[model samples]
Target: MPVPPLPNAFLIRPIAHRALHDGNRTRAENGRLAVEAAIARGYGIEIDVQPSADGDAMVFHDYDLGRVTTATGAIRQRSADALANVSYRTGEVGIPTLAQICDQIAGRVPLLIEIKDQDGMMGSDIGTLGSSVAKVLRDYEGPLAVMSFNPHAVAEMRDLLPDVPRGLTTSDFPKKDWLLLSDARRAELASLDKVEAVGASFISHKITALDHPPVLALKERGIPVLCWTVKSAAQEIKARKVAQNITFEGYLPA
Candidate 1:
């Protein structure tokens, strides 16, 4: 099989952050309303994928279902069918499967699927979850990329679906762990798994103050960069001054 060209979305467009649920009126994170809204607005969709206890792949952002759904147990503890009826915080939206999500926006918009491994929740299995996603999305015939904070999971994805582009997530965000871990540790993780690129996730304020010269320095070498969750035109302007690849949340590109 030939390696297809990547989607040229970031060339000059902004992405819709988790389907534009719009101010928590609906469910937050990767819910139906947010995704649908993103499709309608003509922006790329960013959603998370996690393994169901039944070994199915579902669209969800958390290992624990309580925060986003009616269920209160770990996702690995419940089967996909059990989660089917559990409504998301966005009113009546239920957990969605890979098939359901792909079916909804297969051709409408590009997708960024985050394969989370927070607690190594894919269970004791290694390639099963990653390969499962690979098979399901093999014929998807749409623009997509697999991302994760876990380089090992991303590596598994690389093996399972070598055609799919992979991205690594990091905490440049004004968070506790970033302060706890040295920049050296962060750089070490960034260099893992023969990763093609990186997404620099940080608060808007922190981004402006970031070592811009070094950040774009990566992009200069053909390694594209994506900054996380910028919700304002001002922040976008600031990012444009340094890194052109800035991620946004429902904020219009003025």
Candidate 2:
């Protein structure tokens, strides 16, 4: 079956990166408070998911818990119940499950979810995290889409949630930043060779790499292009020359 069209709602609103986070000064990234803040302000919300030890999808970023939480270990090492009890260093809320986030949003606004790569190196070693996300969103009735930096993970979502729109989170794959990927792998990813095979409906490319040939080519073919982490109004202005929408943070898009 063909992937559903990328909804205009996703293109019309400035998506709040990790839900309008402010360096964790008040609302922590992916925290319940942040999500509520985004909804209150009328922006689409984008969040990442990582699987818990028990194969439940948890709405938190980072493979490790040390950065955002007082806890100190791999997030995948803990059970969903244990993760729900873990405290965030920046706020009072515990880690949220995907189900919890879905109920929180309740279709009030469009949701864009990025499935954080469990394969570590963007390989084919996936299934658990993707399946967990699929299970949680199976009955969700809302305007939403799923994507991943890992094409294999996106492919998994393609099979698991055939009715849901899917996309690729893409980048230039610079060697210095992507040390885990080999030269061949980086070239292949940069080329976006798997986009057609995986059936991506859109692409959220790295903001700085929006002009990359393959991304522009996809845009020429009428693909809706979204860019990530645009931190300021000026960057948003420049990114809009190529991107149809943005995933932004820091200052609010006007």
Candidate 3:
């Protein structure tokens, strides 16, 4: 099957990283408030999902609850209901399920869903996160896509939801930053050897590494290049030299 193209809505609008979250403010990342804020501003919403203990997809950025919530443990250790009731220290809102977030968006704007790497080593040992995300997105009607830093997860989505557009979250994979990944693994990922095999329609690469040779090579082939965490307008300008769109936070795009 041919790779599906990303919707123009996604390519045109600046995607808000973790929604329009303001860090432990009343509008927490991936919370309903953040989703609403992004919707109101007409920015594309970006969120991360991981499977709960019950195999339900939860919209959250961290594998652990320590950063955003009062609790401190692996998010997967909690059930869906338990997770839903755990409030953010600032927002007083519980974490939401993928289903709830989708229903909230209701096709308001483009949605980019990142499936957080469940495999600790970014290898083939993935959990049910992909399947869990697929179940919620199967019936969803919107301009949406799924991606992952782990190629294995993207491959899983290809088999489970062939019709939805998917991509890989690419990075330069600096050794000190990614100590969990061995040199061989980082080398393979940096080369982007899995793009075609995983059926990725686009790549959300690191903003700083937009100049990476493989990423530029993919763009030369007409593959869409999206970049992550562009914090300021200056970064956006630099990233746009190669990236077709951006996932941004900390500052609004003009």
Model 3 C-alpha lDDT per residue in residues 112-208, reported as the tens digit of each score: 9999988899988898888889988999998999999999999999999999999999999999889998999999999998999999999999999
* Model 2 residue pairs with clashes: none
Evaluated against the true structure, the overall lDDT of model 2 is: 0.92
lDDT of 1 at 178: 51
The TM-score, computed over Cα atoms with residue i paired to residue i, of candidate 3 is 0.98
Off by over 4 Å in 2: none
Candidate number that wins on TM-score, 1 or 2: 2
Per-residue C-alpha lDDT of model 2 across residues 81-111, encoded as one tens digit per residue: 9998898888665899999999999999999
For residues 1-254, could you state the per-residue lDDT of candidate 1 as single tens digits? 33333457643456666666575556466777777877777777777788888788888777788866666988877888888888766676568888788889876777877777644432224535676688788888767777776666766766677677766654443335455545665555533323443222211113544454444445566555666677898878776665555567756664
Q: What Cα-based lDDT does every candidate model obtain?
A: 0.64, 0.92, 0.92
Candidate 3, superposed: residue stretches over 4 Å from native? none
lDDT for model 1: 0.64
Query: Which window of ten consecutive residues has the lowest lDDT sum in model 3?
Result: 85-94
